[model samples]
Target: MKTRTWAPYALIAPTLVLMAVFLVYPIASVGWFSLRHHTVTQPWKNGFIGFENFRRMLFEDQLFWQSLVFSAKWVVVEVGLQLVLGLVLALIVNETFVGRGLARSLVFSPWAVSGVLTTGIWILLYNPSTGIFQQLAQWGIGDAGTSVLGNPETVFPATVVTELWRGVPFFAILLLADLQSIPKDLYEAASVDGAGRWRTFVSITLPHLRDAIVLSTLLRAVWEFNNVDLIYTLTGGGPANQTTTLPLYVARKAVDSHDFGYGSALTMAGFVILLFFSILYLRLSKFGSRA
Candidate 1:
């Protein structure tokens, strides 16, 4: 009885310690740093300054607001498009057909690729002088020497397309897994009761996928909001910072400027905004209530 009581705690102790060391400690440190003057380059000015960083970030920083707006736009467009395309892709692969295994593998291969590699491949493809566009131009399809990344007018869409290549696979794989778990009996019953494809999908499939869609979208939104690797390497938040998200801005502040205090404040702001939205979304969507 005594061992049983302590066994659970003992089993979880290592995980609890790891979480404290990695997650809790870092979050606490960031919170503490957010309220201080902790710039690495200016050690002479290092001291506690309550809410000064937040004050400057919330009211005085134009880049912060700009990055926040871009982050919102980026998340909305990326997640919305990925969800739709992923659902379609998942549905296609879920159906019984010749080469289904090969098709599913090919569809999911992009998600297996690392962000750095994906960015590298896209960069090579986007090269103005020696890329797909140049090839098309040589074939008399479009103009030559088209710099998609360099052009402010096209950079946003280019980045979106590039990210969609990698992101859509994630949603597809996740949704596909959930889709397979759906009982076949429901579909058979719906079909026998005179339900057509679209009607059956609307009545049975969508509802069954509700929790997965909500959870996946929320997780992907949080991830995309924090995503800096691909965007950093691909665009470096360039074309006049048009592609810069909030996380990218924070990276610039903390890394480029060594303004740890300000960066911490920005991180805190992101955390609050993300938490609020996540809660609101789960509540509004009534997540997990269906299944």
Candidate 2:
């Protein structure tokens, strides 16, 4: 009887220990550090400075506000566009037709690429000297040697396009899985009722995808908000920090400037914002309440 009682705890002990060592410890450390002056470059100044980092971040940091705004914009644009495009792609691929398998593979291939690798591939395409724009210009298009990444006017759209190329595939895959789980009878029933394609889709497909759409949008929003690798490699938050997100700013402070204390503070702020928004989004979307 004691063995049975203790066996479950023993089986799960390793996982609990691993979480404690990794997740819990790191989070606790970040909270602790956020109240200090722990700069690697200025060891002599290392000491407890409770809320000073937060004070400066809140009252004095313009870049902090800018990064937050940009992060919000990036998440909204990316999630919205990815959801729409992904849904369209998912619907298209869900249909039975010749070469369907290959087409689906080709469409979803971008999601398999690493962020850095995606950035590298896009860099080649965005290169002013020998990129697609230059080739188009040679064929009497817009202009020769267009600096898509370098120009501030065009950088945001260019970055958005690059991210969309990778992000949309993720949405497509998730929505497609949910799409497949939907009952054929529901769609057929609508069809038998003399419903048009658009009516059937609206009445059947969208209703069934509501929960999945909500969950996916929330997940994608969080992921995009925290995304750093592709933006870090592709834009480096460049063109006067125009593309910088909150995570990118934190990376700059921690990794580039060796300001762990300030970075921890920024990280804490990000955590709060993400948690708040995630809760609000789930609440507003009525996630998990659908029958």
Candidate 3:
């Protein structure tokens, strides 16, 4: 009888155990390390420094604050563009069109490619002498495409371009699913009632897609916040820290500088920011409904 009563808990025991072993332990260790000093000079010995790391991150270190701001900007621009462009592309492919399959396949293929590869491709494309973008700029679209990565001003935006390349496909596939699920009858009824295309889209399509829109925004925001590989490969937070984001900052501090305590604190800070915003978004969207 006791065994039967605990059966569900027993089934979940492995998951709990794994969490403790992997997630919980590492996080706790990291938190502990963050409150102390660790470096290659004194690898084993750690001196507890209280909240000094956080203090430095908040006040003294301009780099930390700058990286945080840069990350926020990246999130705003990249995710905003992805949401708009992805939805537009999804809408385009949702209609009856020639070569729909080919269009979707091409649009979504970028997502299948890894972020590192995408970054590498963009790096090549941004090469001053041999880049296609540079070559095309001479033809028409202004000199805006000239070795974008090499330019300090364009480095951040240029890095964001790579992220968009790898991420747009995800949004397209998700939004396409939402679009397909909208009943054909709704469109037909709207047509019968003389509702114009734009009106029908505003009234029926957008309303029905609220959940998907919210979900996509939330997912993309989190992914952008936690991103490392995209920026790491594309710019190395480079062209004089123009492309530095929080994740890259954490990697540089911990891995490169071996300032484990500061780095761990930074990582924890990023994680908390990511987690808090995600929770806040879910709560607001879930309960603060339009209805």
Global lDDT scores for all candidate models: 0.92, 0.93, 0.85
Which residue window of length 10 is worst by lDDT in model 2?
1-10
Model 2 ranges off by over 4 Å: 1-4, 278-291
lDDT of 3 by residue, 186-289 (tens): 99999999999899989999999888888888888888877888888778888788778998998887668888888988988887887788787778577656
Model 1 steric clash pairs: none
Ranking by TM-score: 2, 1, 3
Q: State, as a TM-score between 0 and 1, how close model 1 is to the true structure.
A: 0.93
Where does model 1 exceed 4 Å of error?
Answer: 1-4, 278-291
Q: Per-residue lDDT for 35 in model 3?
A: 89
Q: By TM-score, how accurate is candidate 3?
A: 0.89
**lDDT digits (tens) for residues 1-291 of candidate 1:** 446577899999999999999999999999999999988888999999999999999899999999999999999999999999999999999999999999888889999887789999998999987989999888999787569999999999999999999999989999999999999999899889989999989998999899889888988998999899989889999989889999999888877999999999999999998888789677857767977
TM-score pick, better of 2 and 3 = 2
- Model 1, C-alpha of 183: deviation from truth (Å): 2.3
Error of 1 at 222 (Å): 0.7
Q: Score every model by TM-score.
A: 0.93, 0.94, 0.89
